[model samples]
Target: MERVNVVYVLLYDHSEERILMVKNKGMDSSYYTLPGGAVEIGETLEDAAIREVIEETGLSVELDGVLAVSEAFLEQRGHHAIFFTFRGKVVGGKINIMYPEEIEEVTWMNAEEALKYASLSTEGNELVNRNSTIPYVLRGKVIHKN
Candidate 1:
């Protein structure tokens, strides 16, 4: 079985009512996505999210907490992505392109606007609504493996 592990951060600015997101370097070109990526061996999920955010957005984050855990298999891509999503607060570093290889631009958008651009595998409405973690899944078979 092919397995992919990634960490995504949801950076919230309560004062601004916005979230920081990245325009990702997609398979074709790039698409806007929550700042995140694959976790390497020996790295904790929080560390992965922090590293990925810095790599893709040039920012350091203070994790607020774990937000969600998601897993999905893409039939077309023939891969499974197990994701750890965390709630984060921007702590330091300027907002810029940290890695030109995988990121194009960064933007801050409110929940509504973000919904328009993000191809969210999981619904963020609850994030907007209850401000809590919820189990989320996308298309394909879901297996609870130990």
Candidate 2:
């Protein structure tokens, strides 16, 4: 069985009413999502989150807390992917799109605008709504009932 485990950072700067987001091109892309990606082999979850942020957005961030965990099996892709979303605080570094193929744009979107993006995943909404980590499994297009 194929599987992909990843981390997503939700770095909220409430003072600016902004959230760090990344836009990816192509069909496989999630469009606009938090700054994060797949976890490297042998990498810890928190480390993956921190590393992904820098790799994708060129910003150094520290994990504030865990926000949510979502697991979904993409039958079409023939793999199971687990997403670990965390609350992150920018510590240093400038923002830029380091990976052009994977990241098209990086911006501090207004909190409302970020949430309003059409591509915002269901799991993403749940994370912001509760303002905390939620672990849930999604089987295909529908969320799996616990």
Candidate 3:
């Protein structure tokens, strides 16, 4: 059986040209991604997103809506874990990288810029790969499955 995981992408207007993203820590130095984590037992997906975002970025989000749901089988921490990607919006609190051990740096970038930071692995490609159904622009409502 494969492990299940849930992660969220925290997005803000950023003047309609860019969105905030965090560089993951200890993942080959180029593992930058949205702020999110795995869903704990007895916890809802939404709750996990909020908790993960806060833990990773020290920021509280209003969760504008579900951006996408991604399921990928990959080896992490010595096990194959399925990953779920959820996108949300920040509503309050200051932006700070609290989990330096897991998060190295935070940067805001547009669609092209975001993709540049994504990993070439299937996990990263799946995230950047979008279909017609998923809006190309980084605004409004959207959902994706992989």
Best by TM-score: 1
- In candidate 3, what residue range of length 10 has the lowest lDDT sum? 129-138
lDDT of 3 by residue, 1-146 (tens): 45767656646455655667787766465577767777898776667878888887777886544445545556465445544454566778787878777787776778557655533245444543432123223344567988
Error of 1 at 109 (Å): 1.4
Q: Residue 92's C-alpha lDDT in candidate 1?
A: 92
The lowest-lDDT stretch of 10 consecutive residues in candidate 2 is 133-142
What local lDDT score does residue 136 receive in model 1, on the 0 to 100 scale?
A: 42
Least well predicted 10-residue stretch by lDDT in candidate 1: 133-142
Candidate 2 C-alpha lDDT tens digits along 1-146: 48999788888774847888899785755588888888898777887888899999989997767676678887887879887878778989998778898888998898888876523477667667677654433233556698
Between candidates 1 and 2, the lDDT winner: 2
Q: Rank the candidates by lDDT, best first.
A: 2, 1, 3
Which candidate number would show the highest lDDT if scored against the true structure?
2
Using TM-score as the yardstick, the better of models 2 and 3 is 2
> Candidate 3: lDDT of 75?
48
**What TM-score does candidate 1 reach?**
0.79
Local distance difference test, each candidate: 0.76, 0.78, 0.63
- Order of all candidates by TM-score, from best down to worst? 1, 2, 3
